[model samples]
Target: MSLFTEAFMTALLVGAIAAGIPLLLAGLGEQLSEKAGVLNIGIEGMMLSGAYFGFLIAWKTDSALLGFLGGIGGGMIVAALMALLCVRLGLNQIVIGIALTLGAEGATALLHHVQFSQSYPRLSAPMVFSIPGLSQIPVLGTAFFSREPIVYLSLALVGVFAYLYRRTYWGIALQAAGDKPAALDSAGVNVMLIRSGAVLLTGGLVGLGGAFMAIVGAGIFVPFMTSGQGFIGIVLAMLARGQPIWVLGGAILFGACLSLTTALQVAGVDIPTDVIQMLPFAAVMLVLVFLGRKANLPSALGAAYVRGAR
Candidate 1:
């Protein structure tokens, strides 16, 4: 069999998207959170919650839409904790974030043990849409033109967020909340509200990513299934600076690297499993470090905003 057969190549491309979309969503959400001056380390927990709840809802309701809603709800639940402690009460963001993540992990694990241990269920294939003419073309068609609707939506979000950042009042408020909360306050804008909103939005987006993972990527929810993808998403967000387009690029590239790792293994390359697995993270960091060194982050990216304190 030829290595470059249509089926094999298409599988690689499909795997790349499946692997990357979750990162894309999480990275974008993280970028937004950082823009609002909150480093949300609890996002890993948020993703796990989304995955479990999303899978459960999809399994019970037999509706992908409901699954996504459940995921969004799960993410928001954790986000509220972050907002309450960090944004509203002016606590240590890092400590609160870590606590939230640990709590989510234990909670999800316990819930999974109680509910899904005996009957581990899986979903059928999600709906795949093909662009009428583009899907008829050769290799590129299968890779991109023919994909699940979520793939297209994920790509579209890059453009949507780009527009939001460049030309929107809410986006400006978020920037001001991160860069100059005092000035935003002087201008009568509610910094806390802005930060809280950004965190909630981050949770929703990350939750959607988790749902995508369970319902489309893996078709099942297992404990600790997120596997540090949320942390990787943080790395991607930092590397991309504030550019949604960069996040999209970084996600796709990372996914491609993952596919490469699998391909190397399939081709029987004699490499250590540990080293081979590190390829995706290593390659992404190295490439983004060189390419995104010019990133200028917000001034108060991790500082709490205290009103009227000089």
Candidate 2:
């Protein structure tokens, strides 16, 4: 390969990893929530809210860590609203999530304009910590070790959830709650608590994704900065059918598409930026169609699990 082509390839790989982190994080969290039988369509809203709050906190405190944590808190707050609507009030999950997204967007837009004046500069982000000798490897090292600490966090979360869902008692219990809340309720698992916990955890991780975008990825807060990454994440969750490993695979593919677009643009390719921007969404539509009915979503998805429901 030409030196230019090699450089482009390397850049593409790096960019894909960076772009994939947000989706991977969001997907992993949503996977947990969905495994507990809750469909959180509010990921976009939570991410946006987190983005705004994270940027503001990071900018004001001059602490990237604070900002990142603030983002997680913001997502948790939005998830709390989702919990109130879907879990507490027994509202339609789809409507509740869509509405929350709209509300979050509006709120963040206002906050960005009023509080930050829409120009929150990027705080100095935390550095990626390599895994000692592992960081010295070749292409593999760059792929895994050269990323930000949160990148590792995102990957670790996948493993954590995978083990939690597939091997552990809590994982089995959560999945049982999702599949049949009555069974769990009868088993004294406190279905509501488990589901609510999952939702809160989902929000926190999604918020972290947003914070990464603002502090590490974008380095500045812009209106709608999340740019539908949250939505893509939801689609990824659906595609993976709540499997962490599958979700990571899907995220990497989507991230590759996103990275390709970015790399092409930076390389001054002839393609229109608009078309490149649409690749992620287009890929989503294609993947959704490809999965079709084969995607075995949770039986109780989008339903409020009440005790003793047959």
Candidate 3:
């Protein structure tokens, strides 16, 4: 390929990978939660919360790692609350989730005000380094080996999750809980504990995705920084039919949509930015409407499991 072609391909790949990171992280997290019969609608709010909290902590402590941790911590806390509302109180999952999202958003906005007063410093990370010997290759090198530590970490988690969900005992238990909770409960499995763990995992992963945005993508936190990645993730989780491998594929498709929108603007397309931006959501709506009736969710999904009760 010519130098120009090579460079363009490299750029497109980089953008797609960057866009895919958040979706992959968030979708995988949701996959875990949904498989355990929990539907978390607060992912969007949790992501936003993480971005603000993580950015502020990193800025104050001057530690990118700490900021990332803070993001996970923030997300987990919210998840815990959701668990209490849904699992402990036996409240409606959808209603509790919507409430949690609203509460998380208000809390994040208030916290942002208190931290910045008016303006906050951008949360920055150290320069991403190329791996030794491996980063010297052509397109793949730039796409993978030259990225930040977190990017690699994200990809590694994908493989790890795929393995666990497909190969491990815990994975089987989780699926059983979603498919036939009564049988699993009779077998002495703790259904509530399984559900709780799923929620916490979802929160942490989504939060990490948000931290990536503030620290690496923009190097700053603004209100609603996560945009709609969390909601997109929920759609992706459904589209993937609770399979980790398909989540990766679906995320890439969405990432391609994202990349195309930006690439069009950069190439001086005559369409309005809003028009391009709407494509993803429009597609999401179309797909959901078309597939909603056909999609077969877990038999126990959206129904709280009641032990010793048929």
Candidate 4:
């Protein structure tokens, strides 16, 4: 079989889209939290929680929609704790975030061991939604236009988030909370409320990303399956500098790199497996090294807001 056959290319592009969706979701969620002045380092935990619960629910109920909802709920549960400890109680955001991630890792691993250790089960292929005319446009059509419903929703969210940030009152409030919480508070806007809401919403989005990974990307849940995608999402968000479109671009780039690795492996490239696996991360880091200096972050990011305390 030719290495670059139409079928092969199509499969590669499809894989890239599948991989990119989770990162896109994660980056978008992280952007929201960062805009609201919360670092939200515990996003990894939220994603993991979402993956486990999402897969479990989908497996048991056989409903992808319910599974996605369950995933959102699982992530929100962790986000609630982060909000309480870091945002509400004025604790160390980084410390709390790290703790939450470690806790989630252990908890999910234990649960998987207890429940799924006997027999590893997988989910069926998710339902797809193909655009009528567009789906017939050769390889690119199927790669881009025909996909799971969640893919379209995830892509649409980029535009939705961009609109909210650029032309809305809530967007201004979120920016104010991150940039100058005291000013927002004095202006009668509840800074804590804004930040807390951002964190919770972030969890839901990231959780959905996790659910996508288990139910669609991998078709099964495994311990620590996120593999630092949350952290990469953070990088994408920070480099994006509050631009949702940039986040989408970065996610697609990383996803393409991931697909390239798979393609190389399939072509029997004589390279170490570790090196192949490192392509996506290495590509992101290279971009970060080049562009990170230009990133403009929020002034009060990661700082807990205290009323009247300069």
Report the lDDT tens digits of candidate 3 across residue range 1-310. Answer: 2423655556656777888888888898888888888877888877877777778777889988888898888788888888788876668988988887788778877877787757767655546879989888897799889988888888888788888888998988889878898888888889988888888888899888887777777788877677779988888888888778888887777776777655554444566767766777788788778766555577888777776666
Clashes of each: 0, 0, 0, 0
lDDT of 4 by residue, 1-310 (tens): 5678776677678778988999999999999999999998999999999999999999999999999999999899899999999899999999999999999999999999999988889999899999999999887898899999999999999999999999999999999999999999989998889999999999999999999999999999999999999988998898798999999998987887777667566665566757756887787678778865767889999899998787
Q: Per-residue alpha-carbon lDDT of model 2 for 175-233, expressed as tens digits?
A: 88788888888888888888888899899999989988888888788878888888888
lDDT of each: 0.88, 0.83, 0.80, 0.90
Q: List the residue pairs that clash in candidate 1.
A: none
TM-score of 1: 0.94
Maximum-TM-score candidate = 4
TM-score of each: 0.94, 0.91, 0.90, 0.95
Worst 10 residues of 3 by lDDT: 1-10
| Residues 1-310, model 1: lDDT tens digits | 5666666566667768889999999999999999999988989988988888898898899988899889989988999999989998989999998899899889998999999899888898788899999998876888898998888998999999999998999889999999999999999999999999999999999988999999998999999999899998998898888999989888887786667656555555556657756877777677768775665778988788998887
Best-first order by lDDT: 4, 1, 2, 3
> Which ranges in model 2 have alpha carbons more than 4 Å from their true place?
1-4, 131-133, 136-140, 265-268, 278-293
- C-alpha lDDT of residue 284 in model 1: 66
What lDDT does model 3 reach?
A: 0.80
* Sequence-dependent TM-score of model 4: 0.95
Name the better of 2 and 3 by lDDT: 2
